[model samples]
Target: MSKASETAPSNLADIDSSAWSELETAAVSQQSGFRYVNLCSVDAEAKPQARMVVLRGADRSSRVLEFHTDTRSPKWLELSANPHVTVLGFCAQTRLQFRLQGMVELHGSGSDLAKAAWVRLPTWSRMTYSGGPPGDERAFEAINESVPSRLADEAEGEAHFGLLIFRVRMLDWFQLRRQDNRRALFTYDETGALAACRWLNP
Candidate 1:
């Protein structure tokens, strides 16, 4: 978790391994406290949409990343039309930037993944799904009245909860240092296996 430059290895082999190691570490350990990434997609008119989403889980071998969203959100509609998406993330402390491209599938209400994720959410987070549809016109300004307060409504909230599974097709990794910078790209084949890994000038 130490971000200090003093801790980086001097060997190129170690640096190479660390690039992927960091990603795997981020996937499993939230305690390191760095899990947010920006997800970008295209809307109906082909306009770009971007927002921050938490990395709920990751499977490197499968090249998949997990995220949750409100089923009523516009992003869902966009994804339905076009599943392709990209995730951009940076670790300032480590001076690493990750740009990942992929396709996303949304699991809602009845699916096994969605059902499992919804079951684990805390009551407060569950309440968020109780609000009116996203972008809906609101007449009143009472924020507290927007969401259900009682735990009994948690089941009702599940109707709007959603789980997004992003299958990564490519990943570009970059490392920044005062002395030298390094970058690499990893592309996945149709089978989801790593097809190529190439160094890029940085």
Candidate 2:
């Protein structure tokens, strides 16, 4: 095995807050100002569902995590009923991962944040918002194949978009190394205050 791989942390609590924050900052800064996170939510059947999604932004100061998604997706309904969720992210280049647990809130279609986020979207992404409700089970042939002109025009409308905001409650950071693995756990209290932090053997 490689020396770097051999030193990776095996437990989740071996890293410190400062190190964890640094890793998070680096992950957010690399490539497109977005990070892919594995989002986990509870279905109506009480089963856990997980999917990979792009992280739009993170407010470390406020402990807020933000991402965009279609309001018509099942995950949106799932969060509507149960707001608790877990988001996991891994950066291959850094050999680091973040597992965060929090409550989610879906912003309204016409909200200021939604409008601003929509305005910032490029034409290609705006095209996706024009696709209509996501996850609809219509027959393949019955689907609307015509691309809306507004999609290319970059005009925002009722069907344009939605935003998902997650208020992070806890964050676990893991770093992979060749000799030993390092990990750290950070918890925030109900009042949004930082709770105790600790390291664990990875």
Strongest candidate by TM-score: 1
Name the regions of candidate 2 deviating beyond 4 angstroms.
1-34, 138-146, 151-160, 190-193
User: Clashing residue pairs, candidate 1?
Assistant: none
TM-score for each predicted model, relative to the true structure? 0.85, 0.78
lDDT of every model, 2 decimals: 0.79, 0.71
Q: Mind giving the per-residue lDDT tens digits that candidate 2 earns over 82-198?
A: 999998877665576778899988886789888787777666766666554776666777565665586454554445478888888888877777656767778877665577677
Q: Which stretches of candidate 1 lie over 4 Å from their true place?
A: 1-20, 27-33, 146-149
Each model's RMSD to truth, in Å? 2.9, 4.1
| Reference-based lDDT, residue 190, model 1 | 65
lDDT by residue for model 1 over 26-141, one digit each (tens)? 76677533488899999999899999887887766677788889888999889988999999989888877889898999898889999998887777778878757988987676
